[model samples]
Target: MNANVTAGEAPPRAGRREWIGLVVLALPTLLLSLDISVLNLALPHLSAALGATSTEQLWIVDIYGFMIAGFLLTWGTLGDRIGRRKLLLIGAACFGAASVAAAYASSPEMLIAARALLGVSGATLMPSLLALISNMFKDPKQQGLAIGVWMSCFMGGMAIGPVVGGALLGSFWWGSVFLIGLPVMLPLLILGPVLLPEYKAPEAGRLDLLSALLSLATLLPVVYSVKTIAAEGVGAKAIVALLAGIAFGVAFVVRQRRLEHPLLDLGLFRNRALRAALGVALLASATMGGITLLVSIYLQQVAGLSPLAAGLWLVPSFVLAIIGNMAAPGLAARINPAFVIAGGLLVTTVGLLLLTQANSPGGIPVLVAGYAIAFAGTSPLGVLSTQLVVGSAPPEKAGAASALSETNGELGIAFGVAVLGSLSTAVYQSRMTDAVPSGVPGTAAEGARDSLPAAADAATSVPADLGTQLLDAARDAFAGSLHVVAVVAAVAMVLYAILAVVLLREVAPAGGAEPDAEAGPDSRAGVQEDAAARR
Candidate 1:
């Protein structure tokens, strides 16, 4: 009788049916992140083949991210109002076609244009997948685990993309990376509509066209401005662009507050768990995204490892990341999330601290150990915070909830690059100024340093002592800057731990109601009650 009752009580969980759904859903996340990672390894080939100049190379690498970041909120909200599967189908088609264009492009400009289109298509799928996953998993433990697994795939794609790209580049041409996604995506396109159930926005109001435009206006410039600052320097032009972005961003926020049906319901921030989780996510992003790029440089440039070898070094960190991520739900089930999050921050800080000590000679081992420890700490933080944000939001606001989580993530990435990445460049330039005896002018030095891979290549042809001086200066400068970045990350993680404690409620055990399904402002009776109490 008890068994029958338990079977009857099963709350429409994602059965074998939804497992298939998850595989399809994971495709875009994999591809989007894959595209982002593959380009770094492929940049040399792209430049050589297409005659891509420095600025053009930056565009080729960054346009995809900017377009996706700019359009994510708009697309996610639209999917909610329109229909996730419908948009997913449309996005898949556009993505596949753009992949073809990107693969075949003879010029960098054409490839950049194609990549931008791919970004637009990519933006639509992320929110749909998160929301679909939320709806499918009826059990809280499963919901948390599924989200973790989804996130693991995202990081895994980013981690392995270069390895795949390396193998491809060795075997084929520059376009192969762009072509790889097509076969994987084809199956998702065919099976998605037939298998995934249809879901409507809880309140599918007419599309908020103005708010969408405002989002694009604010986020695009801000993201672009930051990328520029990270790649170049904090010059007058970068500052001006950043100010303009901030101005538009303030305007966008004001407009959202005034609208009856805002593109995103910003009031969702009132939820304590949601807000705290966002804070944790932003800081985690800062640490992970900042270190990943910075360390990749350290691994390849300073440690003098091959592209393939550097990627291989990343395996330990990624493995630890997966383990750290999977541990979160289980830990949350037993303890207050405050302690759990604080513990994660503390653990990550230890790793960052170890990373900071890598400024010394023979520091590669320290770097790897630090990276592994920090990766373990951070791997779970993103997924756990994602769960919290969704848990805090009402189910109807899943679109908004997911978008907001991702916004923090992207912003964290942007800010990390701007702050930590800038510090690295500045330190490198300062230390290397007099160290290189090659008599290269400041302008020449800056230009040479712009593409470090090319610089390393250039070093091979110069006089032996001059080459050693240039390489050593570049190496030492990068190491010093990495130390600064590690310190900053450690500080941020420590601050985030304190905030998580003050803000997040004691996490209840896992056997309770699924957090993501009805945890938002639009769905949960508890949140509604809490609001009423506050009023």
Candidate 2:
């Protein structure tokens, strides 16, 4: 009757030991998310210390994500073969070692290399941890709650990353930010094996090297293109990268279909609930990611708050998001998950609507309020969508399913930042060009139009009256752009809300039938058997 040894009969409900293991699994999820945002606050310090060129700075920030996205599929599948707990421990060791290297990196190139290594290691953690959760929590209700807790830790990490970074930067050096991962990871390395169950797919197939290469070829170019478009706009390089990614992607799909034992089971997408859940998660993450970028800029540039202050202001959103994440499972238990998702999206839409009213100089309160409401409302979808995706798949394929969930989330954020960030940048430039002072130097005007931070820097080199004019104009233009983006985000939420309702209407309640009742004969039977085993 051991929870970890469930075999013939129904999987037992998770007990105290499993719950403790859940906490251990959450450690890496939190650290990975924290790593994504922590560096943003320390960039200035690191840039100064390393004497990084603008291009190098971009690489330092981007290479980590590119590596993570590129390697997720390979690592996920590897986990299923090698053992999830084994991969998790291996990743933890690598992450810790990479963090130390990154912390003391003396040159820009070294830092970039360390970050890439960190990303590669980080890729192994997410899917392994999530799949472990699927193996640990047998009861659907407990599974829902555990996933909620897991997701909330991730959100919390992202939310507090800036604060942690700011506090560390204020007291220590930029290197300290990277070192923070060490302590979080240490406990995981020690406790993960002792408290957690090790699970892997039975008779998992060989690790296909070609499929791994194809996945990397497909994802790296696409992500790079998106980042380029965000930073440099549409160009020949971006177009080429995009096209190449698409070509490789098509090949990857064909390869997956042909392989007797593919790296990923493409058949999982045929499940309506799973497909829609991924769509919901993608759009939600996209919307939130774009808004997060805009909000951070707005706080620092337009509102003129310090990094620490802005981080403090964002605390409420994080707290509310935690509440919402925890509340979502219970809500889904009572109502249909589709209704819960739609309701959350609608709430986010309303919050976005509220954001549209924010204007320059005095908009901080409105912005904060709007962010809190939107984050709280949208938070539930992350937990619920992830649950549906992972829950729908057979337990043996949980690692692959979890990897897909993480991959989609990463893509959503990348695209969201690219598209919406570009939109806002265009609007800001247009507004700033017209509003620039009459006798300002061409260099100053160009710099000011690029971004509010650049504008503030440019202001310092001008006459007092000109500096005031330039700063005011830049802030106003940015605020105007924020309004436009908020409206666009609101519209997107509305559309996605409708899609969620229509697509997920038949999604079963927690502990009920499989989400994909209409799957293929083989998949349907496997899903049902898996569900029954858990019950």
Candidate 3:
């Protein structure tokens, strides 16, 4: 019996069948995230095998994500109009076929095309999986727990993807990495129909083609610009792309407001609870993405750890985060979810402050501990934020809501990398401006100021003492930059925590009744009552 159920009330509970169905849904979720990181370690072997040029290599690695972001909104609402289960199975079939094509492609162009196809197919999986979970798990408590498990699998896959790719590459060709998706997707296609329930909105009208194209136009160039800035710094190309995306974005918003059936359902943003949850997710993902990348580089360049060792050191943090993700839902069932989420953010702020104390070469232990603590605090945010975002929506709009959640995640990561990465580079250059040894060649001195990686290369050609001084100064500068990033992220986390508390305080515990005030604007209360009566 549900804790919130009254004497005569009976909320439908998820039982054995639903649990099994969750495992089925989890398959592609895991596989998609795994694909994101798996190709990284295979880059060298594949480049050698395919003779990929520098630009082709970038496309081969990046196109998967590019396509995923571009197609997310389209597939998200498509599932609501057609059916989530139907979309999931179709996506599984497409993903498996693309995996096979990628596994055997003889040329870089063929491989890139296969990867782009995989991304499109992959975008169909996340929204479908999440929306289907909404269909199967009606009770809020059960829904929260299910979402926790789902988030853990997604994060767990990312954590282990490089390890999985490395193991495959050790004994087999580069193509073996692509083949790994086959086993995962094949089972999903076979079991999905039998285990998963089908769901679609009854009143869902035809998808607006113009809105779909506008969304693509709005997202693709913006994502492209952000990524370009992160890679090559600010340029005219990035500026033009950014401006074009903003223009199209305004058009997309106008069309959505005027259309009978918008591709995205912009009205969903009017719900305060939904908006707050998404804001938390976006801010958290952005800060985490920026810090994660900087830490990886620090481990390798400043700490002088090998790639494998850096990866190994980060496992404990991921493991702790998974643990937190699994535990938060159960806790939230008893406490106010707002409090739980806010408390977790406070904990994360502590970890970020700890990170500011780390130094070069000797700060490995502090870095690892800080990262683990910070990530553990973050686990609750991911789990509950996703739950809140989905639950705040009307049942029929869940697909679009889920897509919005995911799209924010993608944009957050790109935005964080661009902004925080640029900040780090600027700080490093400022510190290194006059630190280069005077006798060094003009080219080496200029190169040393470019980046830490460039400094290492510059050191190789300079006199031994000069090289030592330059490398030491470069390492310290990068470490100091990390300090600045940690402080900035810490401040952002604090502000987000406050906003989550204020905006989400009306949200009920997973097992309890919603506040009467929320019933006024959102209609979530009526929907909950309807769901209860139906259950």
User: Top lDDT: which candidate number?
Assistant: 2
Comparing 1 and 2 by lDDT, which wins?
A: 2
Off by over 4 Å in 2: 1-11, 528-535
Ranking by lDDT: 2, 3, 1
* Error at 365, model 2, angstroms: 1.4
RMSD of 2: 3.0
Candidate 3 accuracy as TM-score: 0.94
Clashes counted in candidate 1 amount to: 8
Clashing pairs in 3: none
Model 1: per-residue Cα lDDT over 1-535, one tens digit each? 0000111244344688888888888887788778877877888998999999988988887788888888888887887787777878888889999999998999989999998998888888787778777767646677778887788788788788878989999999999999977987898889998888666665568877888888888898888888878877778888887888888889889988888778888767755567667877886786678788899888877888877777778777877877777788778767766677788889999999899888634787889889999878876567778877665565556666777777788888988878788777767667665665556545546544654554565566676677666677677777877888788888888898888778665544454433333234344553343234324
Q: List the residue pairs that clash in candidate 1.
A: 325-380, 392-519, 393-519, 393-520, 393-521, 394-520, 394-521, 394-523
The C-alpha lDDT values of all candidates are 0.75, 0.87, 0.85
Looking at candidate 2, the ten consecutive residues that score lowest on lDDT are 1-10
Alpha carbon deviation, residue 508, candidate 2 (Å)? 2.1
